[model samples]
Structures are given as C-alpha cells and as structure tokens.
Target: MSKAEKTKQFIIEKTASLFNTKGYLSTTLSDIAQATHLTKGSIYGNFANKDELAIEVYKYNSGLLSKSMSRSFGDEFPTTMDKLHAFVDFYRKNWRSVFSNGGCPLMNAATESDDIFPGLKNQVKKSFEDWAGKISSVIIQGQKNGDLNEKANAEEYASIFIMLLEGGILLSKTTGDEKFLNLALERITKMIDNELNILPS
Candidate 1:
C-alpha cells in the first residue's frame, strides 16, 4: 500500500475504538487527531470530512468484528447446528472483547445513528441486513442437509437470534453483569435443541 493509503488505514485503526466507545456525535475532530497523533488537516486530507471518516471507522470496526467471528467458526464445523452453536459460543466467550471495543458496532451505530447522526443510518442498516442474511443462510443450509426442520422459517429464526443476542448485549452492558446475556444465550441454545433440531427417526 502507498504511504497515503497506509496513513488512512492507520487513522481508521487508531480511532475505531474511540468512535465506538465515545460515540460519533460526541467524538470531536480533535479527539481523532489526538488518537492518531495527526493534525486536523492531516485527518481531513485523508478523509473528506469528519462525517466521511466516521462512516469509514464504523466499517473498519464492524469488519474486524466480522473477521473475528468468522475465525471462531472456521472450517471445522461442517454442520449447520454446529455453526449456530458456535455463533452463540462466540458471544459467550468473547463478550469481554466485544465490550472492551465499545460493545457491538451494530448496536452502537444503530442507537446513535437512528436520530443523532442520520448520515450513518444507511450503512448501519446495511450491516444489520448483512448479518441477518448470514444467519438465515445457515438455517437454509441446515434445512437442505436435513439437520434442521424443513418447515422452520429461516428468516424468523435469524431475526429471533439477532434480537435475543442484541438485547442480551444491551442489558448486560447496562447492568454491568453477564447474566443477562447468559440467559439469552441459554434460551437460544434451548430453542435450537427443541424447536429447530431435526431428530432422526
């Protein structure tokens, strides 16, 4: 990569956590400058403006999160149920990392951009749609493989999983306790076992 591209990436990397933790509206240009040790002009040169940078930062943070989850699942799990379980397990085992990085980027951006920063709403919306798509795809695969109920609604199941997980994240982060998320994950596992799993005759 060229020096300019590297600098742009460096700025994005350095400030991703800052934007996630501090928030897009509350985070100032000076804050980003301090975080990256670059002047406001340098930051502007790399990004058209603060709004543009915020969008890029959100993408960067979300991308990292996606990569982590993909790694957790890896290629070892051949079955759909295994992947779903791994999805829940990913949150259970990595809640700390998620929280430390300022909670899930989707949740953070969704709340903030819903009203405060309308500019980012589209990107955040796309991110959620993509996330749900991944989950639903897994369910569809399971149905094809006869590992999950053929009648099951993949989209519905995906929505439920996301709602439970995101709700768990919000509650746990608010209460400073992990029980909320634990309870949510427990419910999800039970749902998989009882509602979705297809037992052999």
Candidate 2:
C-alpha cells in the first residue's frame, strides 16, 4: 500500500483501542493524534473529522473479529455444532487477548453510539447485521445437511446468539468480572451443543 494509505491504516489501528476503551464521545482527535504520534494536521489530512475517525475505528475493530473467525474456520468445513462452538471458543479465548480491558468493540460501539451518534450507530447496525447474516447462513447450511434441526429458525437463533454475546460482554465489562463472561460462554456453548446438536439416543 501507499504511504498515505498506510498512514490512514496506522491511525485507525492505533485509535481503535481508544475508541473501544474510551467510547466515541470520550475520545478526541488529539487522543488519536497522540496515539498515532501524528500532528493534528496529519490526522485531519487523513480523516475528515473525529466522527469519521471514530467510524473508521469501529470498522477496523469489527474487521478484526471477522478476520479472526475466518482464520479459525480455515478450509475444512466445520459441523454445525463445531462451527458454533468454534465461534464461542474463539470469543472466550480472545476475550482478554483481543478485547483486553476494552471489551468487544462492536458491543461498545453499539451501546455507546446508539442515541449519541447517528453515523456511528448506522455502522454498528450494519456490523451486527453482517454478523447475524453469517451465523444464520451457517445455521441454514447445517440444517440442509441434516446436522441441525429444521425446526430451528436460523435468523432468530443467530440474532439471539449475537445479542447474548454482546450483552455478556457488556455485563462482564460493566461489572469488572471476567467470570461473568465465562459463565455466559458456558451457557451459550451448552445451548449450541445440546439444543443445536441433538445427540442420538
């Protein structure tokens, strides 16, 4: 990539954590500039405003989750149960590493941007929709393969899964309890394994 493009990516990467940790309203252009070690003029040259930078940061963080899931899935097709398990396992394993003390960026942006920032709220909506669509697609595929019960609704299940995960992340972060996140994962994983899997008698 060109130097200018690299600089823009650098700014996004550096400031994403700030946006994730500090919230959109709390983080300032100066904070981003300071994090990226760029001058105010340099930052403005790349992004139109703090709002634009915040939107970019949300996208960058969401892209991280997307990339991680894609990387973990790899070439082999996972069983319906394994695919769902894989996602939970990834989120559980990466909760501290990827999220650190910041928590899920999508969840953070969804809660913080709603009723606060219109543009950012739209981006978060799109991100969640995209996540749901992917999960729903996997569910439908599993149903077609007879691995998952046809009675189960893919979109509904996907929405609930995403909602629970986001809520768990928020709750865990709000209460400063990582164990809440683990408990949430445990319950979700069991649901996926038991309800979604349907073991033979």
Best by lDDT: 1
RMSD values for the candidates in order, in angstroms, are: 1.1, 1.7
lDDT of 2 by residue, 51-153 (tens): 9988888888889888887654454646767778888888777887655738787778877888879999999889888888988888898899999878888
In model 2, where do residues sit more than 4 Å from their true spots?
none
lDDT of 1: 0.90
Worst 10 residues of 1 by lDDT: 66-75
TM for candidate 2 is 0.92
lDDT of each: 0.90, 0.82
lDDT of 2: 0.82
Task: Residues 46-76, candidate 1: write the lDDT tens digits.
Answer: 9998999999999998888888776645678
The 10-residue segment with the lowest total lDDT in model 2: 69-78
